[model samples]
Target: MSGPIHPPLCRVDQIMEVMQAAFDPAWGEAWNRRQIEDSLAMPNVFVLLVDSSGDLVNADAGASGLAAGFVLARHAPGEEELLLIAVRPEFRRRGIGEALIRQLAQDARARGAERIFLEMRENNPASSLYHKVGFEPIGRRKAYYLFADGTRMDAITFGLSI
Candidate 1:
C-alpha cells in the first residue's frame, strides 16, 4: 500500500458526497442528503473526510479533491458520539477508516471530551478497527436495528475514555 493516507477536513456542504462514497446501499447505512444536512445544522456536529482527488491544495476552494471516506460525529458536554463512519467500497482495507477514527478520538480529546461512544449493528466488520483503536464494548441494545424483511440486529455500543 502507499504511505499513510492524508484526509482533508471536509466542508459542511461536502458531507453528502463523502458519505455516499463510504456507504453501501445493501447495508442500509447510507444517509440521505437531507438527513446529513439536518444533522450538520445541529450544534457541535463535526465531520472528517478523505478526498483522494489528488488536486486538492485548499480546503476552502471547493476543489478539495475526490471523496474517499468520512466520519460524522456529535459532541455533547464531556462526550463525543460517532454517529456515522464509512469508507468508500473501493477504499476499504487501506487504513482510511482507522485514520478517521484515530483523528476523531484525538480531536474529541482536544476539545475536552472525556470519552467517545459509537454504536453499530452487531455484525459490522468495522468493529475490529474500533477495537484496534482501544475501544471496548460498553453495552448492547437488543434488536435495535430492524431490517426490511422483518429481521433485526442488535446494536453494539463501544466506548473509549480519553
Candidate 2:
C-alpha cells in the first residue's frame, strides 16, 4: 500500500483467481480456467494489474501478498474493449481502480486504437470509476445481464476517445 500502484504483466493463474473472485456465478458467468487460458492466448487480450509488493490484489483485501484489483482488455483491429476491471471490496476508493483504467487507456492508445469501450451493468458501483476515468455512456443494451434469480439488468456501454 505504500509503493506506487502500477500494472504488472500477470500470469494466467493469477488472472483466473482474480476473475473468479470478481465474477461469481450468482452474479454472472464465472470464467473458468480454460476460458482464462484462452483469453491469455489471444493475441489482442491482456490481463494486468498493480501488484501489492509480492502479492496480487484483485479489488479487495482478503488474501495476503496480493492487492485486490485487475484489468482485462482486448484490442481488436481498430478498437479496444475493456472486458473487466475489478478491485477487491476493501481496496475500493483507494485509487487503484483509477490507476488501472489509466494504464488500460494508455495501452489502448499505444495499440493504435482510436477509441476504447466497456460495458457494465447500469447499477454497477464501478460506473462512477469509469466516468471518473473519462468514460461516458454512449449506448445501452436492455436486459443484457442476467442474475441467478432469472432477473435481468441493463448494460450501459461506455466509450472514451483515446
Per-residue lDDT for 109-146 in model 2, tens only?
77788888998888887888888888899999999998
Worst 10 residues of 2 by lDDT: 1-10
Give each model's whole-structure lDDT.
0.74, 0.70
The numbered model that scores best in lDDT is 1
RMSD of each: 4.6, 5.4
Residue-level lDDT for 97 in candidate 1: 79
- What candidate 2 gets wrong by more than 4 Å, as runs, is 1-9, 53-64
Give Cα distance to truth, residue 119, candidate 2, Å: 0.8
